[model samples]
Target: MKVALKIGYEGTHFSGSQIQPDKRTVEGELLKALLEIGVITDTETADLSSSGRTDAGVHSVSQVVTFLTDNPRMALPRILNSKLPRDVWAWAYAEVSDDFDPRRHAVRRKYRYVLNADEHDISKMRDAAKLFIGEHNFSNFAKKDKNNPRSTVRKVEKLDIRSQGPVIKIDIVANAYLWNMIRKIVSALTLVGNGTRDIEWIGKMLDPDNYEEGIEPAPAYGLIFLEVQYDPEPEWMIDNYAIKHTNDFYTRESNRFLVISTILEQFVMQPEKGQDLD
Candidate 1:
């Protein structure tokens, strides 16, 4: 039997999502928690796999993973929560085909990059984002590597830009992404917003004939892996008890973070007007 899990994590403390020999990673911590829950006795038996890798400092709202297991009596979410660090949580699960591969089967992936509204021109950024909604070779806007030197062409289905309170959120939905693609796109948009580039610059960058190596990718901290959409949707649900409580906890946690971040920004940007001095 195999079970699919939907989880989320604050990636601030993790090296990244993939496993390495001596480094701490999301997948490594998850596998350890699985062991404590007795999902499988060994890696060979469990055969775990994740949807894809997330870079360090990148948060994920809905990451999916699957594993083969023989354990019948398993409280997967509850047990995983107990064993996992406070930042990671398993929210839902379902039975899936034995051959299910989360990465291969996903049809679309969505990413959201948040920028401080006070720092950039949100309206201009929104205008520039519209230029990305179609098939294009994103070579100038993606990080290239010898191991990943294949085609940089990819299709973007949607590029939705919106503002909420102090931040401007750019949500990009794509079939798949090349390394650092979203960040680089955001950097380009910011350049346009800040009057450093024109909207036409985005169009020219997508042309395969033009290659520019000066593209500055945005920082990884503000980007998030929003969710992955699968075909026909997977039949999945957490028991009512886990679902209700976990949802409540995550919602509250998110709001708390927003409040704290807003306060920090205000504290730094707007200090007390006057102070008594000896």
Candidate 2:
């Protein structure tokens, strides 16, 4: 039987999401748990795959992974959570078709970049985000790995920037993303916010020949895999309650922070050399 899993992880401790021979990873921990439950004997024969790989220190709220198992005694979510580390949790599972491939069938993937733009210009960051909305060759925005043969051109469905006090959230939805693509974009926006780069700098970087080397990618800790979407099929049953609850929580907390932020901004903008009446 093939099982689809909705998993969440605090990626701060792992090397990355992919399974490594020696280093710790989300995939490694998951496979270890599966082995403990007698789902598969070894990595050689295990048919496990993830929606996509997240870089080291990156986090995930709802990552999808799938694996094949023959053990009828294994109750997936219960057994996996028992054996997995405290930082990783398997929330839900379901039987998927034999032909299902998380990487291939995914319709869209959304990522959120969290930034503490305490003293930076939020408007500049939002303006910079506009450059990434359409389909374009993002070769300069991603690290080119030889293993990936797919083109860098991708359709970005949405890119929005919003601020709540010191935290600036960049929500991006796209069909797919290349390695380090989101991070590089975040780095560029930071430069713009700091007045070091202008809107034209973004245009220049997108030019094939003007792409410069050694542009640093943003830190991985601020990035999160917000969600993934698959094509709507009759057999797919989504847990709407879980989705609504999570989004509602984020929305409430975001607004609370924004209120506090606005109050602080007012104080900062007040004249410091005014004559005191007290």
Query: Considering every candidate listed, which one attains the maximal lDDT?
Result: 1
User: Which residue pairs come into collision in candidate 1?
Assistant: none
Instruction: Summing lDDT over every window of 10 consecutive residues in candidate 2, give the lowest-scoring window.
Output: 233-242
Local distance difference test, candidate 1: 0.84
Reference-based lDDT, each prediction = 0.84, 0.82
After aligning candidate 2 to the native by TM-score, how far in Å is the CA of 86 from where it should be?
A: 0.7
RMSD of each: 3.3, 6.3
Tens-digit lDDT track for model 1 on 63-134? 998888888347378767788887777878888988778999999999999888776777888888888999
Ten contiguous residues with the weakest lDDT in model 1: 238-247
TM-score of model 2 (CA atoms): 0.82
Model 1 TM: 0.89
RMSD of 1: 3.3
Off by over 4 Å in 1: 72-75, 243-278
